[model samples]
Structures are given as C-alpha cells and as structure tokens.
Target: MFISISIPLADETRVRPYTIASSPEDGDLFEIVFNRVPGGAGVAWLFERKAGDEINFTGPFGAFTLERAPERELVFIAEGTAIAPIRPMLRRVFEQKPGHPVRLLYAADRVEHLLFRGEIEGHAIAHPQFQFETIIADGGQEALYARIMAEVERRWVVTDNDRMRHFYVCGIGAGVLRIRDLLRGAGYERRAVRYEQW
Candidate 1:
C-alpha cells in the first residue's frame, strides 16, 4: 500500500507517497525506503530527519494488495526499492500460507543494490516452498527479460497448476509494463497479473 508523507517545511509542507517497507508484522515501526535523488525535496527532507523527529503522512492506499485468487501459486518480481511492497506482502503470505509455493525474481543492476537479499534467501532456505533468484538487468541486452521468461517457463508455465497462479510485478514503470506484456503475449490471462510501478 501507499502512504502520503507530510514534511513540515519553513513556509509550507511537502507530501509524497511512500510504500510502507516494514511488514505489518513489524508492528508500530513502519519503514519507508528511498534513494535521495538530486533536487528531490521530499527525499532530502526525509533523509535529513533524525529519530523522534515529527512528520505527517496519510493513507495506506493502493490496489496492489492480495486478492481472492483461489488457491494460487504466487510469483513476485521486484527491482531496487520496488521491493518495499513485496516484503510485507511476502510476510503476509508466509503467515497466512506457509506451505504455498512462492517465488521471487528480483532484478537489480548490481548485487549490492538488491535489498535484503541475504535475509530473503534465508527465508527461502527455511521455507520449503519458497524460492528466490536475482536478475541483473543491465548485464546484457534483454537479458533480464529473458531470465524472467526462463523462470516463468521453468517454475510457473510448466507447472500443471499454471492456470492457478498469480503474478505480482513491481519495479520501474517500463519494466513492469514490459513484463506484463510479455506474460500476456505468452497467453497468461491479464487478470492473473497485478503490478505497482513507479
């Protein structure tokens, strides 16, 4: 879900949408992640703030959350900080359906840029039905898409229960659209895919 963060400035306030990164299981401690981009006022203000500093924000709005999709397999594709929403969703999935098969295809240009990689990999190790893979988008031309398609074929498309699957894609807008297009072009119904892009 998305939240509107309010930054109290000298003259006025600045508001920006942030997807809560912390799991609802994290309780009162909500976390939001961002890279401080140059000339980004909200990002700058957020980074400069210290603990206990007051800020205002509203809404857990977005239609990216889970839905009633029968007993479907779940696949999450995320890039960079787009992993924010996926974390909480994954946690919820594990909490609600530990034995359900879940796969994550995480893309980043560099290994260091992939957030919580080790932590999630650890989850994969512990959860028998959980699997995770990393894709470096810039490594080669169309390499990321190729890898994602390969994963879909190997993990989802080939499965006997392929029709009973839900795909969640989160990343930059273009990437999300491209993946959705690829999946649709490959014959997966549009309703089976859900996305949140920035």
Candidate 2:
C-alpha cells in the first residue's frame, strides 16, 4: 500500500508517493519509510514539519498485498526501501496463516540499507516456516540483479513445485523486470509472479 502526500511549495503543490511501512494490525498509527534525497522538495517539506502539523495526503492505495493462496509457498523479493510493503505482508502471514512456508530474499548495496532487518530476523527465529536471506552487492544494481537471480535459481527454479509458488517482487525497474522475466521464462504463470517497480 502507498500514500501520496501533497506538499505545498512556494508556487504549486508537489505530490510524492511512499509505501506504507507499518502493519494494519498496528492500530491507529501507520508508518512510512523513505530516504532523504538531496534537493527533493517533497521530502524537504516533510522533513521540516513539526509535531501536530497537518499534512494533506490520500492513500492506502496499490494492490501490493498478500495473495489469498494459503496453500502456495510465498516468495518475497525486495530491495532497499522496497521492503516497506513486504514487511506488513509478512506480519499478516505470520498472524493469520502461520503454517504457510515463506521466504524473503532481500538485497541492498550495503547492509545498512536493509530495512527492518532485525524484525525480519526475529520472525525467522520465532517461526520455523519462515526463511530470510540477504544479499549485499556493493558493485551496483547490475550486480544486485545477478545475485538475486542466482539465489532464485538456486531456491525455486529447480524445485518440483516451482509453478506452485507465489512471488512478490519490488525494486528498481531493471531489477524487478529481470526477476519477473526469469520467473516467467521458467514457466511460472504471469499471475503467480506479482511485481512493483520503484
């Protein structure tokens, strides 16, 4: 899910979208994660806001959520801040469908870029059915995509139930496209692999 925040600038309004980071189970409060981009007007306005300041926005938008395939294995692939939506999906799965097998294959240029690492690790420790893997590719997006493809090939492409798995991918356009194509080429149905490009 995401929210489009309207920021009022000197002459006009600028809108920016951010993924909702908190779980719906967290009553009354929602969280958004973002990196402070230099010279970004929307982020700059957001950063200057004080407590109790009113902000205009609209949301809970986007179809990036957990599928209703309770029997299918869940494979979530996220990179950098793209993990925002995946975090809540994982929480929902553990809360409502704990028996389903879930795997998270996350990548970033650096370890510090991996969001919610601790929480995800906690879930892995608590749920035997949950698996988490991290890939740090300092060489850039191309290297990241290569490593992710390698991991996917190792974990799912060779499995007998390869087509029975549900994949959720979110990341840069090139990376997301590469993974989606790999899955599709491996004979998985298009619907079985959902993706969002950042």
Candidate 3:
C-alpha cells in the first residue's frame, strides 16, 4: 500500500505517493524509501522535515500487493525505489509462506543505489527457498531491462503448463511495460504477472 502526502509549496500543494516499506508487523512504526530527485518539490519537502515536525498524509492506498497464491513460485523484479513495496512483501512471504520459492531480481544504476542490499543478501543466505540477484545498470533503464530479460531467459523455462509461477514487477513506466510485455511474449498469461509502474 501507499500513502499520499501533500506538500504545500509557495504556489500550490503537490501530492506524492510513496509505498510503505515497513511490514504491517512493525506496528506503530513504518518506513519509506526514496531518492532525492533534483528540483523535485515533493522529495525536497520530505527531506527538509526534522524530528517533531508533523506531516499529514492519506492512505493505505493502491491494490498492488501480493496475491494469495502460496502454491506458485514468486518472482519479484524491482528497480530503484520500487523495492520499497517489495520489501514488505518479502517479509510476508518469508514469515507466512516459508515453503514458497521466491526469487528477487533487483536492479539499480549503481551498487550504492541498491537499497537494502545487505538485508536482502542475508535473507538469501538464511532461506534456501529465497534467491536474490542484483544488476548494476550503468547504461540506464534499457540496460537494466536487457539484463533482466537475459537472466529470465537463462533461468526460467516458460511452458504452456507453467501456471505455478507468479511475477511481480515494479519500476518506471517504460521499463515496467517492457518487462511485462516480455513476460507476456514468453507465453506467460496476463494474470500471472502483476506490476506497479510509476
């Protein structure tokens, strides 16, 4: 789910949607992850907030969530800050559906841009059912998608009866669309792939 925070600028109020990175099990405390975009008012406003400052938001919005398909293997593809939502989903899967096999293919422009890297790696080490891979796409989104597609082709064998796999992809609009289309072209059904694009 996401929260819409309104930032009051000198001219107008700008609303930005941020996915909650913390798990529901975390109780009263929650977290969000974002990178500061140059000249972006929403992130600028958020970055300027100090302790004791109060910010108003409305949410628990968006239907982009994990499907109740414990029998299916889960594959998550996330780029950049899109990993925010996937973090909680990973927690849910590991906690509630430990038997389900999961693979996370995460990409970032640089190694430093890979969020939660150590934590995700730890998950891989701890859970045999979980696998993680990271791609450094210095050549931008196209490079990221290309590397992801190559990995998918090499690692997964899509077949007519491959109904036991579910894909969750999140990224910028173009990259998300490209990956979704690639999956579809590889003979996966529309319902088998769930995506959130911004």
State which candidate has the highest TM-score: 3
Question: CA lDDT of 4 in candidate 1?
Answer: 92
Candidate 2 error regions (>4 Å): 10-12, 38-41, 67-69, 158-161
Candidates in order have lDDT scores of 0.77, 0.87, 0.84
lDDT of 1: 0.77
Q: What's the lDDT for residue 120 in model 2? A: 97
Note the clash tally of each candidate. Answer: 0, 0, 0
> By lDDT, highest first, what's the ranking?
2, 3, 1
For model 2, name the residue pairs that clash. Answer: none
Q: Report the Cα lDDT for residue 151, model 2.
A: 87
lDDT of 3 by residue, 21-100 (tens): 98888998789987787688879989999988998899979988873535778999998899998988887788775667
When sorted by TM-score, best at the front, the candidate numbers are: 3, 2, 1
Q: What is the lDDT of candidate 2?
A: 0.87
lDDT tens digits, residue span 32-130, model 2 = 888766687878888898889988999868998874536778899999989998988888888875667889999998999999999999999998989
Candidate achieving higher lDDT, 1 or 3: 3
Per-residue CA lDDT of model 1 for 1-198, tens digit only, reads: 889988877777888788988876678878888866668776888899898888787898888886332366778888878898898787778767544678888987678889988879888877888889888767643566566667666665565445656789987646578778766766777888888878
Best model per lDDT: 2
| Residue 31 shift from truth in candidate 1, angstroms | 1.2
